[model samples]
Target: MHHAESLYEINDDLTPELMGRVDEVIQRYANRAGALIPVLTECQKIVGYVPVELQEYVAKGLNIPGSTVYGVVTFYSFFSMVPKGRYIIKVCMGTACYVKGIGEVLNRICSEFNMDVGETTEDRRFSLEAVRCLGACGLAPVVVINEDTHGDVSADKIMNILDQYT
Candidate 1:
């Protein structure tokens, strides 16, 4: 876990460390518009998810509207307002997967981790999400452990899969 003080490294009043790093990134790009994406990406890395304070900081640094920055941040599916966990556990709840008893699998995972869909563990070790489709209907009732896929899974299989991760 990061100490509470460490968070100030990114969100505090433009420390020399932060200014030096963010400014260097902004200046590297010939156009401010070109720097937008990289600036947000770098900021996310520094502060976990993009906090409102960081959004204002980024706007001032890039000389863009804060609303504009917020819009871009929220527009992208990849961007998250909340910090993510170490492992992303996506249960396929699409029609095919659901039909094949995906709900039972989801319940087992939620029960074991003591978390609901879209929630990360307090330790930030694992996160659960439900997706529309993983494009593996043949592998119905699928669960993706990060990038690797496990097909035709049962509730009991989830425990074993989680063990591999821990």
Candidate 2:
């Protein structure tokens, strides 16, 4: 068991240094009211995403219920329980984009990256999302990488466009 544990460390992201920072955040807000959000935000900034382990840690630190921490994390759109990629790829699934063959573009990305929608690549290079619409009907078959909007994207052209980012 010791050998196995040594080989595979759990919560590898939560190192002593990061946890110390987290402790500081908890201390700064432990005496204040409505401190959960700010604490979570600060900790997330320190440790990328707020995993369940950190949630329970914060809950214990604040003397709050674990469910309360979980609830707040789930309720807020800004708080993400999972890690995000460096580049976020939003593919429009609106009627206009669909008619313009956006599916092919989306499929191309999934096949090339070996990831479905709402999943991040293994290298953490990109996160794929299929939004209902991007409000750009004229720019059908749109793929937005981070904040850059790419319109009229095709399967053949997607790999080249994505290559520009890295």
TM of each candidate vs. truth = 0.79, 0.85
Show model 1 residue runs off by greater than 4 Å: 1-24
**CA-lDDT, candidates in order:** 0.79, 0.87
Best by lDDT: 2
lDDT, candidate 1, 36-56, per-residue tens: 778888766655567666677
Consecutive 10-residue window with the lowest summed lDDT within model 2: 1-10
* lDDT score for residue 63 of model 2: 87
**Candidate 2 error regions (>4 Å):** 1-9
- Writing each residue's lDDT as its tens digit, candidate 2 over 1-166 gives 1121221255777777788888889999997999999999998899878888888888988989999999999999788888878899999999999999999999999999999998998888899999988999898989999999999899999999999988
